[model samples]
Target: MKDHHPHKSLDDVHESVPIHGGKSKFKRVISFFGPAYLISVGYMDPGNWATDLAGGSQFGYALLWVLLMSNVMALLLQSLCTRLGIVRGKDLAQCNREIYPKRMNFVLYVLAELAIAACDLAEVLGMAIGLNLLFGIDILWGVLISFADTFLLLYLQRLGMRKLELFIVGLISLIGMCFLAEMFFAQPELEEVVTGFVPSLPNSAALYIAIGIIGATVMPHNLYLHSALVQTRKIDRDEHGIRKALKYNFFDSAIALNIAFFVNAAILILAASVFHKNGMHNVAELQDAYHLLGTTLGTEWAPKLFAIALILAGQSSTITGTLAGQIVMEGYLQLRISPLLRRMLTRLLAIVPAVIVIIVFGDEKVGQMLIFSQVLLSMQLAFAVIPLIHFVSDKEKMGAFVIGAKIKFFSWLIAVVIAFLNFQLVYEEVTDWLSEIDNVGLQACIVAGALGLFVLLIMTIVYPWILKRKPSRSDIHISFDDLEFKQASSFRTILLALDFSKSDEKVISQVLQYNPAISRLILIHIVESASVKYTGGQSDDYETRKDLARVEQYAKFLKEKGYDVLFELGYNNRIKAIRTMCGKYSADLLIVGSHGHNGLKDIVFGETVNKLRHAVKIPVLIAQ
Candidate 1:
C-alpha cells in the first residue's frame, strides 16, 4: 500500500505534464538523443583526422592501438561527466568552481578555454584546406569561406538545437559513407591490418604520434558539452529514471563513437596499405594521398574517393568545433557571445598566423602551422584531465556514483604519462629550434636559458610533493548538512523565487517538505526590463492580474495539502529583487532554485539561491 499523498513522495508527479510536448513516445526519445551524440563527436575534429592520417602514413598502422585504447578510456571519463551532471543538476565547469579553490579554478578555466580555442584553429584550417582540394578555391579564399560557413551553421541553430544536431548527424553519416567507400576500394591486406592491432612502438616518433592520437580523440571541451547537454532532458531525479538516462546515454555515446572509430581506423588503414608500402615516404597532405591513390591502386577511383572523403571530414569537424566554442563560453564564463561573434574570434585567431604564412612563406608553411596547432593541443590536455579526475573521485561530492578505485588509478596513470609526454614534446621542439641558431654566442645563451627553465620546472614539480601542507580548518566552508534547508518558526516569513519552470516547482515543493512552519510564502518573479512585455502588457493593472493568478494557483495547491497559505508577488531585477524582498518580508530563510548560471557566477553569485546569500545576510537554501 503506497502513500497516495503528494507530500509523501515525488514519484507521484514523475508522470506529470511536461512543458515540451510531442505526439508519440518515439518522438520524445528521438528528441533527447540528438544533443549528446552529435555534440560529443565534435571533439573528434579535423585536427584528429590530421593526426590519424599522419600516424598511419608515417608509422604504417603501428599507432592504431592508441585510438582503440583512448576511445575506451574516453567512454569511462564521459560517463562520469554525465553522471555528475545528472546527480548535481549542474555542468562540469560549475562543479569545478564549487569543488576547487577560487584562484586554482580560474587558472584551470583559462587553460581549458585556450585548449578549445587551439582545437578550433585546427578545425578552421582543415576546412579551408579541404575546400581548396574539392572546389579548387585558393587556400586563403577557402579560409575566408569557412568563416562565412559559421554564420550559416548558427542560423540552423535558430531553427532549434535539434535541427542543428540532425544536420550534423547527416554530415557525419555522409563522411562515414565516404570512408566506407574508400576502405572498400583500397582493400588493405587483412593480415597486416590485423597485426597492427597488437600495439607495438617502432620508434620515438611512433610513440609521439600515438600520444597525439590519444590526445586528439579524448578532448576536454566534449566533457563540458556532454555534461551540460544532458540536463536538457526532462528526466527527474528518481532512481529508475536516472538509471534509464545513464543506460541510454551509454548507448548513444557508444554508437556515435564507434562510427568515429571506424572512420578513424579506415583512414589509418587506407594510408598504411597505400602510402607506407611504397618508398615515397613524405606524404604531407590529403592531396599527397590522392596522388598516390592513382599511382598505387592503378585506378582513378581511389584518388577521387580520397578527395571526397577529405572534403566531408573537414566540413563536419568545422561545424562541431564551432558548437564546442559556444558551449565552453556559455558554461565557463556564464556569458553568451552570439555564434557569429564566436566564429569571427576563432577565425581571426587561426587565420592571422595562417594567412601571414601563406603570404610570406607560402601554403606549405600553413601545413606546418596545422601540425603546430595539434602539438599545442597535446600540451594542454593535462590541465582539463587532472581537474576531472580529482572531482569525480571525491566520494563525498559524488556519493555512490563516484569513480571506482580501478578507474581512478588508470585515469591518473594516463594523466601522468600525458603530462610527461607533453613536457618532452615541448622540450624537444625548443631544443631543436635552439640548435639551428648559427651564431655560437647566441646558441650558448639560448642553451643556458633553456637549462635555467628546466631547473625551475624540476623545482616546481618536486616542491609540491616534498613539502605538502597539513589540511587546516580554514580550508573548509559549507558542508552538505549546511546546504539542507530548515523551517523557520511560525512567526517568520519565507521568500521563494519562482520562474514558472518545473525546476521552480521542485524548489517550492522542497521548501514545504522540509519546513512546514512558515507563516507566509512570498513568491517573486523579476521582470528584467521595464519595457519588456510579459504575456500581458507591462502596465501595473496587467502585472497585478498576472501575479494574482499565479498566487491563487499556488494557494489552491497548498490548500489541497491542508496548509494555511498566503502569497505575495514582486517584480525587479532578479538579484536586486531577492535582496529587497528578503529585507522587506524579513525572510527567515531564502529559498531559490539553481538554474540559468554556470561556472564562476554559479560559485560567486551562487546561482539563484546561492546568489541571494551574499546579497542578503541570511541563510540561503538552494533547492536543486
Candidate 2:
C-alpha cells in the first residue's frame, strides 16, 4: 500500500517503455509510437461509428467537414497532452488535483468518470450488437459476454504495456482494413466526398449529429489518457530529449490520429455511398447498416466484415477506456486499485445502464443510445479540455515549455467552440424536454440540474484564471542574504554500503576524507542475488560469498588505517537491510556509491540511492 512514486502518473507503466539513445532517427521516432495509437482507438470507437453512420446516412457527405475539423482539434489537443506529460511529468488529472481544491477536483473527477462511463456504454452496446449481428446471440447474452470480456484486459495487461500496445495497434489496423474494403465496394464518387469537407449543416437535426460527431471524434477521456500515456516512454528528462520527444510524439499523434480520421471518414463515406445513394437514408442503426451493406453491395462478406470491425472497434476501445479510467482515478484521488477491479467497476457502471436500456426499451433503442452516449461525451469534453489548456499554458509550472500565444489562442478557441456547441445542445434539448413534459415538479428538477451543470461549467472555465495557483520552487527566487544557513556538523559514525564496483575505492576514499575525527566506519554490502533475496543471510550463493569477501577486505583496509571498522553482509531488500545496519551501528551518516542509472536502468537495477535515502533517517551521500 506504500506510495512509492506518489507523484507518478500511471505508476505501473511510467517510463516503462525503453527509449534507446544514439539510435537512427527512424528508430527514435518508432519508440514514441505506441501511446498515440492507444489514443487513436478512442477517437474511432463504437460511439464514432454511430455518429458517423447517422450523419452520413441522414445528410450524405455534409458532416465530413465536422470529422475533419474534429480531427484537427484532436491532433492539437493530444499534442498539448504530449507536451504536458513530457514537460510537467503529470497527467491532466494530477495537474487538476494540484491546482484545484479537493471539492473542485472531486467535481472534475466525477465529470471525468461520467465521460468514461458514457464512452464505456457505447463500447458495451457496440460489442453486444456486433455479437448479435455476427453470431445469433441475443442482445442480453451479448451484454453478458461483453461484461465477461473485462477479464481479457487482465490477460492483456499481464503481457506488459508494449504487447498491449501491439494488440491495440493490430485491432486498429484490422478496423482500418475492413473499412478500406468497405470503401472499395461502396465506391462513392470522389467529387462528392471531397465536397463533404466544405462544411454545411443540412438541418437542425444535422447540428445534433454534428455535435455527436465532434464529441465522438474529440473525446474527453482521451485528453486525460494521452497525457498519462505519453509518460510511458523512458525519455531522458533533459531539454534535448524533451524536444525530440515532443517532435516525435507530434508525428506519432498525427500519423495515428490521421489513421483514425481515415477510419471514421470511411465509415461516414460508406454510409453515404451505400445507404444515402441507394435512398435508404434512415440507416441510423449499426444493425441496419450491417444488413443494408450485404444487400446493397450484393456480398455477404461486406456485412460480415462490418460486424467484425464493429466488434474489434468495441473491444479495442473498451480496453483503452478502462486504462483511462485507471489513470483518472489514480491521478485525481490518489486511489490505487488492481487493474481487474478497476476494469470490473467501470464495466459494471456501463453494463447497468446498458442492461436497463436493453430490457426496458429493447434492442431497437441501442443505436439512439450510442448517439446519446456520444453527446454526453461531448458535454463533458470542456471539463477535461479547459483544464488541460490552463495547465500547459501556465508559465510558472511549465517553465520554458509553456505553450506560445498562437497555440494558446487556438486551444482556447477549440475550448470555446466546444463549450458553445455543448451549451447550445443543452438549451435545445432542455427546451424540447420541458415542452413535452406536463409535470412542473419534474420540470423544476430538470431545470435545476441544468443550472447546476452550467454553473460548474462556468466555474471550470473561470477558476484557473481567478484562483492563484501555487508556484513551483523554480519560479521562486530569493537573495542569499535573506536566507538563514545552519552551521555544518561533522559525523562521528558513518555507514557506507558497497557494491564492489570500481567506484567503491573512490567512495571509501571520500568517506575517509569527509571526516578525519569520525570514531567508527561501518562498511556494509547487501547480497541482492536470488539466493540471498528470500533466504536472507542463510544462502551460500557464489555472488553472496564474493560480496562478503570484498566487504571483509575493505574493512581490513580501513582497520589498517587505524580506524574502527565493522563489516556486515545483508541478505536482500537493499533499503530495508541498509536501514537495519544503520540502526545497529548507530550510524550518524550513510554513504553509498551512485551507478548513475536512470530511466529504464533505474527500473532494471532499482533506484537504490533514492529509495534508501527515504527509507533511513540518516543523511545519505552518493559517491559519484
Provide the TM-score for each candidate, comma-separated.
0.66, 0.75
The TM-score that candidate 2 achieves is 0.75
Question: Model 1: runs farther than 4 Å from truth?
Answer: 1-32, 436-624
Which candidate achieves the best TM-score against the true structure? 2
Any residue pairs clashing in model 1, and if so which? none
Residue 191's C-alpha lDDT in candidate 2? 98
Tell me how far the alpha carbon of residue 314 in candidate 2 is from the true structure, in angstroms, after superposition. Answer: 0.3
Clashing pairs in 2: none
What C-alpha lDDT values do all the predictions have? 0.66, 0.86
Q: How many residue pairs clash in each candidate?
A: 0, 0
Which digits, one per residue and each the tens of the lDDT, describe model 2 over residues 361-441? 988888777867876786788888888999888787788789999999999999988888876766776788899999999
